[model samples]
Target: MSRVESAVGVAFAAEAPVLIVGAGAAGLCAALAAIEAGAEVVMLERDPVPRGSTALSAGLVPAAGTRFQAALGVADSPGLFAADIQRKAGGEADPATVDAVAAGAGPAVEWLADAYGLPFSVVDDFDYPGHSARRMHGLPSRSGAELVDRLRDAAERAGAALLTQATVTTLFAEPDGTVRGVEAERPDGGVERIGCRALVLACNGYGGAPDLVRRHIPEMEGALYFGHPGNRGDAALWGEALGAERRFMSGYQGHGSVAHPHGILISWAVIMEGGFQVDAKGERFSDETRGYSEQAAMVLKRAGGVAFDVFDERIAAVARQFEDFKQAEAAGAILSADRLEDLAALAKLPAGRLARTCSEVERLKASGGTDAFGRTFSAGQKLVAPFKAVRVTGALFHTQGGLAVDGSARVLRPDGTSLPNLFAAGGAAAGVSGSTAAGYLSGNGLLTAVVLGRLAGLAAARLV
Candidate 1:
């Protein structure tokens, strides 16, 4: 809880080897890695606690070739995972960064579970979009809050100094872009200047900044901002001022199934499990299975900025595994009926159109044919009786673009050279996703968080 105080106007001398801004998954993991490497580390958090964008996520980190996957008889490898990412991103991602994350994800997950004692297990029940294997690892409760909490506890236990309510606003660096330290402002208008041998920016992205979002991803300007409010593009701004390169400025992760009025997130499992989304007019618009991130724009435009997610009892059972879905059910965001017309009545949709849509879906399932929107219905995954529905809206979860970095997460210059003693991870760095929302593979955010975080921590410690 102590901020190394300095003589007024004189910057504090280097108090630690590595100074990390932001205490989310990326910063916490970076601290753990630096501490493990025998470097004194200090993690500064703007908020009173460590929960950031990681807490708002589903707590799933997809990693190929993990022991949990092997134990479940699932075959996978980093090569396969990297290929999937490239395919999803349309080959727009940096090859080295993609390969590094895919290769490091498994080891990072295993390390967290084995060393930190986090109860992580493979999510074998269902598949997220763009992931070819059952590689998502999560805690027992499948909640991001639990993931952040456990990581925080582990980091503190491992001797990393976790300081809260320290909002870093300025960087103290040499004229040549060699960062020496930062200036963090407290709520009481007190300034704390902390110096370090190396610096890591894990403060996340700019989804919370309206101006930045409008400048980069103009399409999602009106959608609900579901990410942490503290993500104000601090890293990008700081990097730009320091002459660090930035890439994929338009990439982001958006969700299509946030339950409206109640503000609860309904898992996309409902759609992936053969359920469908309908507009207010009670008609299927786009291919719901294409990917949930892309589905956000479709839901907003095709569904008049709002829609209803229609699924059956079986899909609901699959969705019940998520805490957010359970919370949605408790909030009355989920409606149920045994028949399509009854369901339509509860949702106040056109009953005739709803019935016809259901019949068309059934026909497509029986014939195994593609619909007008080009979505092929699989006969094996059919929606049965006891239908459930949730009124939903689109939401911008987080930004995926920021300061460009090398495989080791060293902040790079515009000419592809590394900045001295500066690193970035998680949302603070450009992600593997390409320049659009469609390129986001499932769990790519956390993938970079743990993988690049550890890499940055180790690399920074070596520099120290």
Candidate 2:
């Protein structure tokens, strides 16, 4: 399956001790770690910039036992974090890999903050569905674009050369499945054959690939893909050609609350903070708090492919911290009114049914009783005057499944043996979310990116 000769007299255009494909969070973090470990690094990016799915995310990374967590007097441990991952994943995830990522995540966050000067702080407010503690850490903006920009600047400052608009189209590997180099095509249709002692596949997963989504995740085949267009499953294809193991091809991160028409993501914090969703018929459907990822199919199947997220001014204030929410508000996606009927009229929803839904929600909160959907409305603060609503639709963010790797982030064969000098991270590797979207806990994507990227970089640097 090799497209180029592995050991023949091929003209080499460039070389590096460590070569990484794709310049997303994984590639940038790997470059940082490799440079810190005294190895020369080169990164190839298909786009003009380093933003991938990372830019589309909220930029939150969950960790255990970090200084940020301790500073807030929140007690957490890696063991507890691993347990939470397993429980959320239905015990289908690999125990060893879960343990390794849980252990490395905190240290990776600290390293990025202390060594690279990325301002990191744990979110102390609402907790994501499955996390036991408020361990989500992010930059001040709480936006993935900020995180990617900071990481890119840090990598460049550390002397890691980043080549943008360089698309790696083919791999040069030996018959024994040992990768030796790659052929990258330039925008002008020129090709460059680059050699490397070690290679890292950080190109991300296949959410943008309609054919792959139809073949694997058929449930979300025609859904809106909100991930990076450059995530066309190049890493998964290369891994297959190199005889590397692949797993959990159906797993993905699906969101139910992307502001439709505006294309801005309404933060799930709204729902976590006493907001509820109403379908076109103005009826509450499903337990929204089960997980945002699983809410995608629910919104699609039961909500006539669109729904309205209803919240109050208090919840809106909490959601205002997210950059996406502010963007949504600025784009006029957020409809507001002092009265519920007027707010429903503004969103073109059924006034009477919407009122009934709110009344039911209030009843649940007042009585502290579980609704028919198994979701309990805690007797917390009630939603007061000035209501808010947004039109939302489900979207596929990215795939969580790809090439399978070991604890060190080395690509593995079907028999569980490592591929020589080949590693995968981020969306390019099977994630800890098991084999479905329901198993996804918040921040799982960034966790794998930082933790496995750091491990892959350190291990690859050792080989050089």
Candidate 3:
């Protein structure tokens, strides 16, 4: 039950077939695949099973141009998906890398639905901003926790042993520079060594570590991190210790949420659907129609990624229209106010300036002025008098940058050479979205995790 007992040092008579660091989506998938391939696998997790960011995710998986989409009469191709990624990444992503992900995405999604029983549902005409096709998928349960539960079951049924609350302290390497295993510290202050012929790092990103952010990204100079507390850059540290190539440490995805007194991240998916984001003076800023990632980036760059959600009694009345609004309010994600002055005061904005800005917004609504994106407002009439304000801060949803890996999910060194006996996948592997302007591609993250994990598992099984 305790981390120390779970990870108490016991050397394997010989190296196990595969040792996966982190029992998140990537690690669980890799362990299950390796075990299914008749290889012995051990998975170490810093947190308990069925917990962590993977469980906390929204679990949107997008595999564009697949046979499923084609069956649904949706027109798409891996090439088009790759091209979109390349364009969004500003030509920073390697073409081969993007192609590899797109190529395996279809199979990976199918495997999740069929092999693991992920309860996926096909959604026609579901639009992901900036993408040409409607290729987004979601769970019928509509909760990431449900998907993670299924993954945990699959991994266990496949004979993968999961050790929770076990933090890998260092990767053990042979003299020839091949990773052999890992050393970990258990929650009970015990040291444990797990030896294996191959090591896979799926430990995710360092978005929660302010020190790492300050060192790698100057833009986040004073920005508060809004990711999982356990994401302290341990994976990045271990990779760096082995001279692994790193990328996109400076870039991170931002979330629009209410930062409560205790720093809890309430989902912005609510505000986006119900209310509008405004600046300190209560004026609309940035394109509201932009993708969540793009909006987060803009807010981070311009307004420090913090704003107030301004909504009137009508908008509040219609709050039940969005599931996120109800959940956020239930979870105390939204701050409330009755009058504009009191709302401004609670949101720490100048009352007079906020009132003036709101008045201007009302006039613009009446006259149909241009919106934040220069688009003529059609919903201006919805802005009735007596508005409410909720203070929202920027939160990080997931990390974009990670270890440099090849198409096969092999971790490459700085010189583009493969790390011996070492592979990476999931958020721990890099070169996915940092180069693309369109942030996330729906199921891109989870799909990549499953695909790269299977590849790593199969490849590790072949290693001597």
lDDT of 1 by residue, 1-464 (tens): 11222223556844778999998899999999998888999999999989999999989999999899999999999999999999999999999999999999999999999999988998777788888898999998788999999999999999998889989988877777877778888899998878888999999799999999999999999789999999999999889888899999999999899999788889898988788999999999999887888888898888888999999999999888889998998889999998888999999999999988988988998899998888888787777789999999998999999999999999999999999989999999999999999999989898998899999999988888
lDDT of 3 by residue, 254-291 (tens): 55544434354433333433346777766667765455
Lowest summed lDDT across 10 adjacent residues in model 2 is found at 1-10
lDDT of each: 0.90, 0.91, 0.67
Q: Which residue pairs clash in candidate 2? A: none
For model 1, state the Cα shift of residue 12 in Å. Answer: 1.1
The local lDDT score (0 to 100) that residue 461 gets in candidate 1 is: 85
Q: Residue-pair clashes per candidate, as listed?
A: 0, 0, 8
Candidate ordering by TM-score (highest first): 2, 1, 3
Q: Looking at model 3, report the run of 10 residues with the lowest lDDT sum.
A: 1-10
Order of candidate numbers by lDDT, starting with the best: 2, 1, 3
Every candidate's CA RMSD: 2.7, 1.3, 5.0
